[model samples]
Target: MKSVLLLSVLSAAAVSAQPKLTLKVHTGKGQTGYDVNSTMIAGEKDMLVIDPQFTLSEAHKLAAEILESKKNLALIYVTHPHPDHLFGLAVLHQAFPMAKIVALPATVNAAKTGWPARQKFWFPTYGNNIPGPDPVLPEELTEPYLTFEGERFPVTGPLQGADGPGNSFVSIPSLKAVVTGDIVFDHVYFGVPKDAARENWEKTIDQIAALHPAIVVPGHQGPGATDDMSAVTFMKRYIEDWDKNAAASHSAAEMKAKVLAQYPNLGMEYTLNDRVAAYFPPAAKGN
Candidate 1:
């Protein structure tokens, strides 16, 4: 009886020493919001969601998944200020009122300042699929890292990414995983606006690669994309291709064609359109 009791105690101790956190990703459909990835990092009793969704309906679906998990929703961390990453805060807040939604100060400010313009621009296209006028914005996160079940998940950056600047990503050391906001994308066209600094963005990708994370949850990915270093490799190659093609082409259409020919199967062609337009806007009518 004593030997059995000793073995039972040893089993419990081993279980207690194991890592308590696990991660699950909920990716949007390819046609919906460019297959944006929203990850749920769950501890033994509580969980944290990173980057909600673009549409209210999709957010509802994400909320349902969280509900099914049966873990307390402790926090929601917005990775960047883009509407696609943050527009669903209202739905999530309504569903999990107790969860504290937070982001870096820069992200919070950009979201608040860009909300009106973003709503005006996307409302017509999304039509009632998005949140109404008064959406819930995340509070400014003052801490350097997030804590879940006594483990530290460090928040790094405000660095330049495909979406421009003020982009932050979260790292789980125990998991050797990084929840990259727009810093990385898997088999998806990048959103490179007019003001984007390609050099800086490349540097950011290098920084992430240096970490050698096993799991990389990008801001966007194609269907069946794996969470691995392949995304980082793709991002670097895509940026190099963009630079080479952009320099060779005389018009936006030419640039688009070149890029498309190179990455014919990549998702989010709309992003490529935006990228070319930003780099090669049509010449003035008089010219």
Candidate 2:
């Protein structure tokens, strides 16, 4: 009789410790031509968010979702300093003041440094739709992990990329998942800048692949989290193809044509053309 009671108590405890995670994805079209993803992870008692959406309207929608969850907003993790990733944080902060907003130290610094310039650049395009409220500077993520209801949420990397430092991922081991920011891309064409460190980005991908996350929440692209390798594989192919062809091309149009011919189905041709023009500009006349 005592043994049976003990077993029941232990089983209940185990179930409580391993609460199921309810994931909600808020997707928005970035003005820069790619999609942005903001993932919300709700547990039994509290909820955590990863990389809130890109605009005020998108952030409000995400905030609404959090309000509907009816759980304590525990934390908001900004994966990197990119405007699309950090711009919506202020909105989330206003809605959930108790929720801790944080990121890797370097990421926080980058966000602070670039916020003003980015606002200037994007405001004209987004106009009244851009971030108007004062920006909220996120606190530094001092620890390497987070805990909610006694479950572990480990963070990894200042993953270096062509875009420079400040890339990171949050691993929910129990769920066998990871929220990868810009380190991995989905079906969209990746933003490859001039002097991008292609080799380094490849190494970062290998590092993420090592985690063997069953579900990936990529920063851009579609379908939200999925148990597949399509995102990683597609990103690898895109980068390699770009690297191989970039040197051979002399003009942005030529590069765009070459890449589009190879990957006609890849969305965001405008982004590709913009990157090519910005990185591989045409030589000035009479040079």
Candidate 3:
């Protein structure tokens, strides 16, 4: 029994010490994602980074893993305005200043409008546990512009869609895929907050699908087809259900039962329960 207990303790320690697995999307050198494997393009000199992982510790660990491949991480592309895919950047930037921060037409514009408010609101609920990066104050920097999107964007006339359909794109012809931001989410959870509109999100996904990328690197989740069709399908279904219930219509208990009944194989533990409570109406207790 003592021997068995010792072996179990060793096994647990080994598991805890194992660094998080990263999915590498490119055939190139050390350029790989630390967690969900970011898509990278290898140049003669440097490599371009897709979205970094979500937390500071995750980013630090990811960086150490990349150094093992013996390549320099050059640019960072912020996929969209969502905090999960884009927040690790502040610390990453401080670590790799040479790397450029790139994005779409309204990417930062959306963040500029939403992040401050979200930071304020989310702090009350999640702040105490979140990894704090002490982001460089927004104004302390001059944001970069996209080369394809033109120095002064909203390129009028035929490309008016730069902010919409005909949005600007970044291509590392060598890689055969663009690091699409939140334009694509694979087998993962997706719930939009006030800053993001479902319709706008859908539009971006449609545009990404049009790109015909062989390996589309979504902002979150593991790398997959840029045209991952399932996200669109799942999102559409959720929207339909959400619309039917209309935020305030369902009581808490009914909401929980409805979620369990409909998505029996869905969220485990308190996560699903919390989302229901946070996003839905209160239960008619003792009913």
Model 2, which residues run further than 4 Å from truth? 1-19, 30-34, 193-196, 223-227, 244-250, 284-287
lDDT of 2 by residue, 155-192 (tens): 88787654556688888887778788887777777776
What does candidate 1's lDDT look like per residue over 161-255, in tens digits?
87778888899988889999988888888865334476788778788778889999999998547998888777767777887998999988899
Question: Model 2 reaches what TM-score against the true structure?
Answer: 0.84
Question: In each prediction, how many residue pairs overlap at the backbone (N, C-alpha, C within less than 3 A)?
Answer: 0, 0, 5
Candidate number with greatest TM-score: 1
TM-score: model 3 vs. ground truth: 0.57
List pairs with backbone clashes in candidate 3.
23-37, 30-69, 33-38, 79-181, 252-283
Scored by Cα lDDT, where does model 3 land? 0.48
Q: Best by lDDT, which number? A: 1
What is candidate 3's CA lDDT for residue 127?
Answer: 58
Q: Local distance difference test, per candidate?
A: 0.86, 0.77, 0.48
Order the candidates by TM-score, highest first. 1, 2, 3
RMSD of 1: 5.8
TM-score of 1: 0.88
